[model samples]
Target: MLEDHRMSDISVAVLCREAGVSRTYYYHHFQSYADIIYQENIMSVVQYMRQLPDQGIITTTTMFTRYFELAAQSRDTQLTLVKVGLESSLIHSFESAFEYLVKNDLVVKAHPSRIGKKYWTEFLAGAVVNMAVRWLQTGMGETPAQMGRFVSNFVGLTE
Candidate 1:
């Protein structure tokens, strides 16, 4: 699996053989390795986020803590994602996911600033995803709880 090898070192043949599936089956389910990775990680997070209570106060700290906790649970997958040069794709996925939350009113507005809702959500998503990428790049020295607090504080996203 990915635990023992770099993503670049694993080809479709190796993956299909290990999973006991044909190349056709693999192609039927996924476009590529990156697609599998994206679905398994980012999509799971998005699905979790979608289930969050849309009617609550949902503190920024709570939101981020849950986010980072989920990310931490998938630490290896995330690191591999960055290692495979999919950081931009990861960012795009998170941004799009965040936009979905906004459109669905799953999250409260951080502030009533001059910024438009769409741009404001983009700004927030960009900041959070950038922090996550940096955290992964620098070895994730901080715990998920710590990261949650740090990001919330840094963004002035207090309660």
Candidate 2:
């Protein structure tokens, strides 16, 4: 449905018809089409993160690059979400996932004793989310490797 309709003024009836599911079943599972989109976006990020190996500057760069690649693959769905004003949910999902990874030591980073880990995680997550949104908004002009390098430089990740 998204590939064909692109979420511009899509309705529950149309979605249900496309999926060949009853409206009752669709409503039972999803509150709205936006909810479905949000869950799919979150699931994609979490699944990718889960598959990432260990933690280090290199791993971090790989994760960022892989995430950008994934986003590039689903650019259409993402753009639709942006058009429908659900971009914040997408950003929040990534921010939450990244924060969890940071807190659990899944992503390597040094934390200052003066500031809490949560604060550092939130700061990093916000920066990354903003960069990602800008990248998507601008048609992902940079390759994943370029984006990874830019993020690595911004975060002071060294070899």
Candidate 3:
């Protein structure tokens, strides 16, 4: 529905109808439409990352690459979020997803510096989210693999 209509045009009632769920269920689970989109996007990345084999920097690069790939595939949704002034939601999603990886020990060897794991994860999450926002805003001309390698190199994840 978002593809065909602007967010402002879609009401919660409409969404509930489209989703075939009761308003009670929707309200019980989600705060708003934006929350629904945010959770869906973040969960998609988390699920994808969870399925990947842990392979050090290789896994990091692949994960970052997949992030870009997903963004590109969801250009419409990305644009809509930006248009609705919800770009921060996208940023938060990336940051939260990265934190989840770090916290769950899914991503290894993240602390190359003397920095604590918490700080290192925070730094990387900020860097990744900023880079991702810029890439999406600027038409994402670079390929996902290229962006992935660039991030890995920039963050010293690669030797």
Candidate 4:
């Protein structure tokens, strides 16, 4: 199969030539390319999130560290997410993760002397999404352990 071949047209013919597998065998494995991508890419995100500790149970540093840890594990899917245009769901997932942090209080709530607590949550969540997108575009830049320190400093995560 040509590297430039459209995955949207990765039919039985393509798979057959690429893997030396018959059409029937391909069907035995995957219903369609999208089906495989859904089962593998999307579901893996949910699984990875499930594996993450609830924010209440861990330190703020651990929370952000685990964020990158999960992302590193799913780097391919993260890139596939950008390549395949999953923006809305990606935003939703980011918001959901942010909410988890807020509800679990892993991040510091903004005091009245500073920004509103809601703003802090939104800011931190958006910052996390930005970090994630950058990581997908390039790489995580630092170790997950180091990422934890960066996150702690960035979000003022001390309790």
Candidate 5:
């Protein structure tokens, strides 16, 4: 229904009626219909990230390919989330994903216990997200693979 009448005069009331649900129930299932948009967006991101071999190299190339595919599929949703100012948990979600890669030893950190002999993980981690945010803004001239390699190289995280 949202797909059919998203830009039309059809409204929340009409959606509720058409779906055979109360306004409360409709709203309850989602924080307004738009919430479904973002939730789907996040789930897609999570699923794409999940596909990389957990026990193998989750290289910059791999990261780039997956993320790039995700961005292409849901650019609007990603743009909205990135621009909306990330929630702490949202940022943490990225952190956790990287951590998983680290644990699987797929990321090949300079030092698993202490990369480059320092807790440079924070710096390394931030760089990925920072670059991603930049991509969100300008997307500049970089392909997702290129951007991924750039980020991976920056942190010395080799495949």
Candidate 6:
């Protein structure tokens, strides 16, 4: 429903009707419309990240590319989310997911100081999310691979 209508314009009734679900069911599962949208965005990123191999500079590039690809595919929804102040929730979701990778030792050979690691994790996640949002806002003039390389290089992810 978010893809079909602006976030500001969508109501619970309209969404429930369009989704063919009862308002009770929707309310039972989602706290609000923003929650549903946030969960959807987070799940999409999580699913893509799960398909990637363990973390490394190359893997980071792949992750960014996949994120951009998803954003490009769901440009309208992303734009609406941004417009409705839900972009931070989406970014926080990504940040938490990336932090999980780091905490689980999936990030091979990343030996930064504890404080540095925390800062870098937040920085990288924010960069990727902001860049993806910008790309979508600008009509995604660059291909995913192109933006991927640009991000990788910008972050000095190359060996």
Best by lDDT: 3
Residue 150, model 5: lDDT of 76
Q: How good is model 5 by TM-score?
A: 0.59
How many Å off is the CA of 98 in candidate 6?
A: 1.4
lDDT of predicted model 5: 0.60
Query: How well is each residue in 1-159 modelled by candidate 4, as lDDT tens digits?
Result: 223455666667867767778888768888776555555544645664576666445566766677777778877666666666654445556556656655656555534243345466556656775677676577667787787678677766654
Model 1, span 38-114: residue lDDT tens: 67666767765864556655666767776776666666766766766666656666666666655655555566462
Query: Which parts of model 6 are misplaced by more than 4 Å?
Result: 1-10, 53-58, 107-111, 114-116
- What does candidate 2 score in Cα RMSD to the true structure? 3.5
On lDDT, the stronger of 3 and 4 is: 3
Give the TM-score of each candidate: 0.73, 0.74, 0.75, 0.56, 0.59, 0.76
Local distance difference test, each candidate: 0.71, 0.70, 0.75, 0.63, 0.60, 0.74
Residue range 120-139, candidate 3, lDDT tens digits:
65677668766877788898
Quickly count the clashes in candidate 1: 0
Candidate 3 is scored at a TM of 0.75
Cα lDDT tens digits, model 6, 32-113, are 8767867886787677676666544335567667767777877887787787677887687778777776666554332345
lDDT of 5 by residue, 1-159 (tens): 433333246677887788788888867788655565456655765787777767666555676556655555555555565554433323455556666666666665544555544545455546665666667668556777777677666655556
Lowest summed-lDDT stretch of 10 residues in model 6? 107-116
By lDDT, rank the candidates, best first: 3, 6, 1, 2, 4, 5
Question: Model 2, range 1-159, lDDT digits (tens) per residue?
Answer: 654565666787888887899999988999877688778878888776766764443356776777777677777767766666677766777777776765676665533341244466556666776777788889789997788778767877533
Error of 2 at 88 (Å): 0.7
Better candidate number, 4 or 5, judged by lDDT: 4
Ranking by TM-score: 6, 3, 2, 1, 5, 4
Angstrom error at residue 137, model 1: 5.5
